[model samples]
Target: MTWTCTECEFAANEDGQDACVACGSERPEEEQETAAEAAENGDDSAPEVVVIELPAKEKLGVKLMPPKDGVIDHGLAIDNINNPLLENKVQAGDLIVAIGGQNVDGMGFSGAIDLIRKMPRPLAISFEIDEVRRQEVVREKFQQNKDNDLDTQLTTYAVVFDNGPMGLNLEEAVRYGIDGAVVRALKGQAKTSGMISIGDIVYKVNETDVLCMPYLEVMNVLRNATAPKTLQFVPKEKLADVQRVNSRHSESFRLRESTSHVKQKLMNNPRLVKDDGNEGDDTQSIAQLIMDNKASPNVTAEYLLELRVDDRRMVMACTSESDKK
Candidate 1:
C-alpha cells in the first residue's frame, strides 16, 4: 500500500510503507486514504501555530530628586565634589538641588557625574561630606544644570549586585543611581571620586529607598520632590550567586522551550518535499536534539525539573546525559 504525508506531500515508495520516503513522516495506510479522499473533496484544516509566553518577574527602580541648597554640615567634604577636569564647580557647603524626571526638566544624578568627569578640578571647595551626602550633591548639580538649560542631558543610576574580586563571593555597585550598582565587595583604597562601593549600602543621598520600584517612579520622585529624600536597605550577601544562577536558568529554559516547539511543529506537519532526487528526513528524540544544541553550561538540575512536566524531551536529555561517559 502506498501513502503520502498530508503535510509535505511526500509519497511512499514501491515497497509497502508506513512513512513518507522523503520525510520521516509516519501515517497509517487507512489514514492516508481517508486524507486523500478528503483532499479530493477540497477539505482542509489550517495549520496551528504555537506561541510560548514566558513571564519575567524581576524588577528594579531608580528615583531622581531636585537639587537642594544646603551647606556641607558633615559626611563627604567639599573637596570631594570639586572636579576641575570635568569643570564641575559645585563645592562643599555649596547649596544645590536635584531635578529631572520622566517628563520633568533637567538632568538627574547620573548626568552630574559625567559633568564632573568631563570637567575635573583640583582643590575645588565643596563642604566635606560622606558618600550619601555626595550623592545628594550630585543630584542637586543635575537639577542646577537643568534649570540653567532646558536642553540639559539627563542621567540616572542603576543598582546591581554581583560577584566580588574574590571568586564565588559577591559585591554591589550603584551606577548613576539607575544604570549601575555600588560594588562594595572589592578591596581597594577608598576612592576620592568616580564610583564608590565601600560596604553594601550607598552612604550618600537621602534615605528614600528606590529599590525594585518601577524606573518611571524613581524618575518621578527625583523630578518632583521639593525636599531631600533618604533610601535605606541592607545589601544582599549572596546577590552575585543568585543573579548568576537565575540568568543561567532563564536561558536554559528558553532554549528547551524553543526546541520543544520545533519538535511539535515537525510532528504535526510531517510534510516532506522532493525538490531534487535526494530524500530529506529529519528525526531525533528531544534530548538528543537539545544536547546537540546545548545553549549554556549553567543549566541546573532544578531548571530541568521545571521542564519535565511540560517537555518530555528535556527530561529525556537530562537522563541520557547522566548515563553517558
Candidate 2:
C-alpha cells in the first residue's frame, strides 16, 4: 500500500517509516484513501467553501486586528450594536480562525485583510472567544438556572478568602427585565471561573434576596456575609451579548493633531487654563501653553503644577487649581 503526506506530499512507501520522510509528519488516516480516490476519478478541483447562515460580515461590524508575527487567530471585538449579540454575534479578543473555510493562521496582517476582502461578502467568519468571555458565559448560565416553572433559583459560589472584595460591581439589570443588581466590574484576582463575573445580575446574597433591592442594602448583605455564600444572578446580558460587549474596546493609534490644531483644541481641553480672577489674556492665548508643553521635553503635571509668579496671576494645573496662592 502506498501512503502520501497531505502537507509535503511526501511518499512513504516503507513499512516501518510511519511518518512523512520529507516533513517527518504522521500521515492522516484518510490521506492515502483521499489521494487514491482523487487520482482514480481524476478530479483535482479544490472543494467549494461552505456558506453559513449568519449576519452579513459588514453589517455585523467587526474590526479585524493586523496580524502579528504573520498570523491572525482573531480580531478585536467592538460593540457597534448594543447588548443583543444574538442579532450578529462576535466578541472581543476573538481570533479570526478562518474565513470561508480558508485557514488564515500565520498569514500576517496584509495577507488576512487581502484574503477577507477578496472573498465573498457576508463571508462566514469563524472565531474563538477569549477565555474570560467563556467563563463569564458559563457562570451566567449557572446563575440564571430555572425550573420547569422558569423561576431563577439562587446559585452558590465558594468564595476564595482573598484580601480582595467580591470580584464584581453592580448596576441596574433593566434591559433584560430582570429586576436584579447587575454585575458591573469584576476586580482583578476576583475574575475567575466558578466565581461571580461582570454582567451578572446578582439577585441574592446569603439568606437575603437582593433582587428589587437598593444597591446599598445589597452591598451590606454581601459585606456582612461570611465565606461560601449563596449569591444568585442572571447575566445582565447573555453570553453572546457580553462577548460582543467585552470585545468592543479596540486598540488603535490616535493621530497627533498639528500644533495649530492643538492650540485651537485647548479651548475645551481643560488642560490649559486662564489666570483666576485676573483675566489678563483671552482664553485663545493658550497658544503659549501648547508651546510650553512643546518647549519642555520633561513637561508633566508636576512641572505645570509648579506655578511661577507672572504679574500676580494665579494659574492652575488641573481640577485642583481652585486653591488660590
Candidate 3:
C-alpha cells in the first residue's frame, strides 16, 4: 500500500507510513487503505479506446508541462480565463491523481495520458492543490500590482500603432451599461503597452464610470484624454471557465464540397481579386473607378470608418458573407 501527504501530495510506500518525505506532513489514514484495495484489483481494462471531444469552440485552456524525474505532475500551472478545467472547479496548480475512479498518482507522463485517453466520459477527476502555496502567490500579486492607485488611477499612454491610434473598437451592450459604445477592437499600441487586450470590457473613461453616458460625452472623454489617460477595463475571459459562443462560424472548405467551389467564391469577390482595389494603385486610379470614390478626410465618412474599424471583424464577416453569397 502507498501513503500520500495531504499537503504536498507526495506518495510513500507501506500502510504504516506516517510522514511524507517531500514535505514532512502527516499522511491521511484513509489513503493507505485505498492503495491497498487498488493493489489487489490489479489494473485491468479492455484495449479499445473511446475518445470524447469537448464542447466545440471552447478551449480546454490548459498548458501542459513536460514530465521531470519520470513522474507526471498533472498539475494546472496557469489558468486561462475561459479554461474548461477551471470551470470544472479545477484550480491553478492542482495536481490530478485520478480520472474516472482510476488511480494515476504514480504514473509517468505518458502513462497518465494513456489512462486519460482510455477512461470513459463524462470525466470525473480527483486532484489536490497546495492551498498554502496558492495563497502566497495571490497575496504577492495583490501587493505588487494592486497596492497603489489601480482603481482611482489608470496607467497607460495609448500610443499610435502603425495601423492606427490607440483605442478599443466598441459595440453597444446596453445590459452591461455600455449604452454608448463597447470596446471590441484594440490597436497594437494599446495591447503592447499593457493598457488593454482583446475582449476587454471598458467600464470607465478617466474614472467617470460612463454608465448611461451620452455617446458624444463618451467620445469627448476619449478625445480629451490626449496622453497618459487611463480607461478602466475588465477582462471578459475570466467571467467563465469555458466560453461557449452562442453561435459557431467558420469558412470551412468542406462546406463548399470541393476546392473548386472555394476558388469560385474567392474569384467572385471583387475585393479578393488582385488589382480590384489594390493599394498599389494610385489615388488618381482609385478616383477613376466606376464605383463612388473619394479621398482625404471627409469628417462624416471618417467617423463611419472609425465605427467600422472598432468592430473590424464584424465588418469583415458581413463583407465576406455578402461577397460569398
Q: What is candidate 2's local distance difference test score?
A: 0.49
TM-score of 2: 0.24
Q: Which candidate order results from sorting by lDDT in descending order?
A: 2, 3, 1
RMSD in order of candidates: 32.3, 21.0, 19.6
Candidate topping lDDT:
2
| Most TM-score-accurate candidate | 3
Over the stretch 97-145, how does candidate 1's per-residue lDDT look in tens digits?
Answer: 2111011114444454343334322212112113455567778777766
lDDT for position 63 in model 3: 48
- Model 1 spans with C-alpha error above 4 angstroms: 1-209, 214-219, 236-325
True-structure RMSD for candidate 1: 32.3
- Give the clash count for each candidate: 85, 12, 7
**Candidate models: Cα lDDT each:** 0.35, 0.49, 0.46
User: Judged by TM-score relative to the true structure, which candidate is superior, 1 or 3?
Assistant: 3
Q: Lowest summed-lDDT stretch of 10 residues in model 3?
A: 241-250
For residues 42-116, could you state the per-residue lDDT of candidate 3 as single tens digits? 632211111123343433445444456767544323332356546645444445555444455456767766655
lDDT of 1: 0.35
The sequence of per-residue lDDT tens digits that candidate 2 reaches over residues 1-325 is: 3355677754322223356544567868676566668768975353211123234554334555454455555342322233354333444433455555455654566876776667656555545435665456556545544221133222334334444455566764433333346777776545664566667666567667665554566777778887666666555445333222222221211224545575456566666656555565455345454555644442223213333476332333432345334
